[model samples]
Target: MDNIFGDAAERLFAQTCTPDVIRRAEQGQPSGDAWRACEEAGFADALVLEDHGGAGLGLADALPVVVAAGRHLCPYPIAHTLLARAWLSRVQRPQASGAIALAPQGLAIDDGRVAGTNVAWARSADYVLAGIGGQTWLLPMQAARIEPNGVHGSLDGGVSWALADAERIDHVAPLETLAASAYTGLIAGAMDRVLAMTLDYANQRTQFGKPIGRFQAVQQQISEMAEQVWAARMAAQLAFQGEDGLPRPLLAALGKARASQAVPRVADIAHAVHGAIGVTAEHDLQLYTRRLREWRLAAGSESHWHDRIGADALASRSDALTYLRTALYGKETA
Candidate 1:
């Protein structure tokens, strides 16, 4: 789908998210400039209501911007901020500024405050949205004592907020499913880039005096990689399917499960096809591959969603087959 939001975001990132920018971000550089560009372009506020001074686009419309960010390996929390703004507006809370790192599943509130470890982008984010389901707390990073873990090669870290300063908003929209859908979209876009890069390399890199694309073994790996790539693409489309711009929970779970499952194999095949050169710091392959690995674990792994699906099926009144049909096709079984 050709959308002004997606098209503009693609163009914006293409110019700002160059190899040098990715390298600098991976090296722990601040992503202020790129983030400023996004903020100025009004991408984060894409989903907020027009009455709230936003474009009031739906999740389906705004997701392309997130996918574009993933395709470009955007260093900041663009998707997180988009979801946050949307949620804040849903509960009639004041529209927030600055990058908001969303912690959808991890951490909990106690005594009106939240403390959590393994918060992605905690070191760099201005605020963290901590909650489960419809209730969420927005805590400023300035009030917290941030302990940077530096894990996953990004801004992942541990943070403890001054709970008294927390802004708690109840009856907010559930974010886990929203996050899952967007994460799957990111996986789809990143895998597309990786597959394209691998294909180009296979046709160019020579082995035994011939291009590796001509070899049966290398061709087999590329074929497998292509299968997963398209599967992820299809899964993302399914995940984003919903009514009135809202994603169905079952669809989100299935999409995230399938997309997350594709990550390890896709990253492995891309590296395997390129041999040692793919992992070199100077090469661009590792940049995307590492983020692919990280995104797999974000929000929840495949196993987490798989178990959720299985449990739901078992708990449903209908048979397994009917449940599956209802989940995938939205048709109720008699």
Candidate 2:
């Protein structure tokens, strides 16, 4: 994974995406000030072509950055922007000046109307991207009504545009898979952070006059959580391996399916290890955990992708092992 973008994003998000900042943003606070810092760091345009005022990096190269965003539980749609900007650039659409978001699943675009429920970062985005009737559409948020969902402002939102004053950029690959692939990277990073946080808590927190981490039961849970986190990371890495700026559909499915499967287990164990504090609104654990659950369901949940993978495997007419190997490694089965 390329650390150059990730390292920069880590530093920027550390300051801009603090727990308090995220908390405020969820309360309908405008994150424009914090987002401006990202703009200054040149992260929002990292994947756009050099000619288009972006770094010209590929989606694979942006994996680490997505992970970094996940680590900090970044409220902005950094994961979406990396791919969206690159896609828009490739199609030569007019540049989006602020944070742009990708909305997948349940999106309805028809007869010049665009609508969706629980669109990620809908309240925060200045522009939105969606696959509308097999064509890429860029809809500015100015004309849309954002109905906030969840407690924290626009952690997600229900958005609708009656007239659909948006541009149909181009017809290309659906953004759902690519969005899910980048999201897996984000999930992995956040899961790793949760693991680290859980480990630190278990080690420092005392039970029966000894560190909880010293207890066999606690240790067992921690070990299980560790395995899940590392497995999720590997899934993201596998999902992100692609040549040009997009991930293979099967790889993306596998990555998202695996990572999403890990979210529930990992979040359960993290809270189990923390006892009560993990669920508290003030604690940072809830921030990451909540996002993890939402992210798992976003783009396509584990069940959704698993069904796709299983259908593909069935369609291949090969043995399970050979089908998996071919899907995973892009190899032809004998």
Candidate 3:
């Protein structure tokens, strides 16, 4: 909620995450410079304790940084890095400077080794954090046999790994919850940028000797886009605020579901408004649109979170209105 931190993040991202930098990253070139700059700016360690070589900022303070990173489409494993730092601090392990990957599911740990397919960003990670049978493990990427798959949208590609006899560590934070929270911020940032681009284009592009924005149909679509972006931003803020001492799953599910569902609608409207140019790689719209779609399915899909929300609501056993109120606002209805 504090613009002090958010504004600083925005300035840093604006300076570091330039279009050239993003273009280089999109071409599969190393983005080490931007990542190092981000680390120097304390973003990589924002979630860790100061005593443990981090900024010691709360989730509220750290999330805006994530939002800024998303807005610029920073070509780094930012969410993964934040989650890894938190896990490392929790387990008292020294944090490494390289990227970290999360093994969400379809992975098994046995005899001190881990074997899994399609581990997100495993090719670039120095460490891979995984949950196994209610316990967490941190595997060294160097020890793993990594096979790179093709890229997934604008985000980095996934990898398969066979890591033998890797080490395991304890983690205090739920990786999924942290990831979902960060992703909510990322989606909000993307939508914000897309809406701005669409608005600018609508006002500048003329049809029938008048700006397209002057037309009622285009105005209505832009209005809907603005509404969705606002809703997504609010959902992300609510999720960030509810991160501490609240029902994390409910808040995360709500934020992520709302934002994810908005992705297709927002992307369609943005592309439609921009005409054929928006779909081309030459245009900047693809950068935000691709990431939005990828992030929507990353931690969990909208359908997945919808099921979780439904299950939580069913478990509450109260009227729908009361449950909705308590879930969204964290206040019980009278």
Candidate 4:
């Protein structure tokens, strides 16, 4: 498919979506304005069909926008929105408006219960989409009691909205796959930012009367970081290419597994080379790294994705080569 993203999104990122906006998001400031701004700018409408007021862009084109958002550590519920759009489309749900997070399997639907939710973003969203017993549920955002949660003291903040059983509605979709896809894209985007920032830091920071990048050890670290990003990006792109037939669950599983592994490696290398300054909250690297770690466990953790992918592969009784080719290239030619 053609790339739907042009220069406009990039320009917007440079002009309006600055690092400070991300800081505000970290501080629990209102991101509704930013979210609306992105929606108006065509990013939110990427996956939606033209009939649904979207550009009908495929995953290939939408990947870059996700990457950009991740790079900025954007706090706008971009991933949630993406998942919501996908879930609505698959289930043919019309006029569905809300923020959606891919919760862990088996959320409790008991009276006044709000469980199994993870990384939920819609603090003020009109609705919340959740997964329960392989089904998606739509709940009013205001109904649930939101509990503030964070990751490693970073602003990996989220709320657990509790709802009574009577208020629950069953709306099922391929949520596992949707969550995996969006999470993969978000982490890959953040990985790209990590690589860029680390590279610049290496070049700018001086040591022993020369740039740290000139040192062999530092260069090796940078090379390894780049390689990790490359691996993660390739996995993400391959997953995107097979968006049609590839099971979203399996694809998302692999995407997140690779990203969870790659992101921390990249961040560790960057911080090691950048030294103590890199670890501080004030530095931009921590912002990206913290979010990376948080997103890793959001849709599912590394172990979760790994087991899911392994199970799918093992359960596929068809020819392995055919499955592989169809998965990576979108087709299998005998």
> lDDT of all predictions, in order shown?
0.83, 0.83, 0.75, 0.66
Alpha carbon lDDT at 262, candidate 3:
89
Against the hidden reference, what TM-scores do the models get? 0.92, 0.93, 0.89, 0.87
Ranking by TM-score: 2, 1, 3, 4
Please give, for residues 1-334, the per-residue lDDT of candidate 4 as tens digits. 1144835555666666677777776566666666677777867667776777767666677777766766666666676576567546644567455444445454565565656434345443545566665555776655555545644434433444555422434565666666677777778778888889988988898888888899998888889988998888876765564453223455666777887778678878978987899888788888788778777777677888788766766786656776666543435556
Better candidate by lDDT, 3 or 4: 3
lDDT of 2 at 202: 94
lDDT, model 4: 0.66
Model 2 off-target regions past 4 Å? Answer: 109-112, 150-154, 327-334
**Model 4 segments beyond 4 Å from truth?**
1-6, 104-106, 122-126, 150-171, 242-248, 317-323, 326-334
Ranking of all candidate structures by their lDDT, best first: 2, 1, 3, 4
Number of the predicted model whose lDDT against the real structure is largest: 2
For model 3, what is the alpha-carbon lDDT of residue 286? Answer: 81
TM-score of candidate 3 relative to the true fold: 0.89
How far residue 116's Cα lies from its native spot in candidate 3, in Å, is 4.0
Prediction 1 global C-alpha lDDT: 0.83
**How many backbone clashes does every candidate have?**
0, 2, 1, 6
Best by TM-score: 2
